[model samples]
Target: MASIRRLVLDVLKPVEVATVSFARELSDLDGVDATAVRLVETDREVQNVTLVVEGEAVDFERVEACIESLGGTLHSVDEVVCGEFVPEEHVAHADATWLR
Candidate 1:
């Protein structure tokens, strides 16, 4: 079976939650080796963030729960990286032309 190597998400969250704390929390999830959180936009009430999660196999459900528990909402799953063996070149040149 293929495993999830990476995931990128668009998230809307309250301002109280620090991105570092959020990233650290996600890093603790099963199969998640690392996490990167970037603040795309910010407002008085909420923050828009780009979340990048990487690991051998990322359990998305758990990730969602974690976000919710932290008073955040997952707006969308923007990118996903999954395979038994993901090559670096493939990641660099990700085109859906193979579907043709």
Candidate 2:
């Protein structure tokens, strides 16, 4: 099976946990190499965040568990990359309606 190389998740987290701490904990996961947490939206009780995680073989279960432990809910898996290599993203040309 191909290894999971990257994951982009939409998460909702309690404001109590700082983004820095949440990102740091994700980066510390066994198979994770790095993490990028972007604040998408926020309210008095929760924050909507986009979490990007990259690694040689990211463990989705562990990532999900960590988020839950930190009072977060996984809203959706926005993106996922699984293979021996991570593919570069390409922008669709204006004339390429089919690609879009």
- Each candidate's number of clashing pairs is 0, 0
**Across residues 1-96, which tens digit of lDDT does each residue of candidate 2 receive?**
788999999999999899998899999999999999999999999999999999999999999999999999999999999988868888777856
Q: Per-residue lDDT for 17-59 in model 1, tens only?
A: 8887889999999999999999999999899999999999999
Estimate TM-scores for all models.
0.83, 0.88
Q: Which stretches of candidate 2 lie over 4 Å from their true place?
A: 90-100
Residue pairs in candidate 2 whose N, alpha carbon or C atoms collide under 3 angstroms: none
The lDDT values for all models are 0.91, 0.95
Tell how far residue 13 is off in model 2, in angstroms: 0.4
Q: Predicted candidate 2: what Cα RMSD to the true structure?
A: 2.6
Clashing pairs in 1: none
lDDT of 1: 0.91
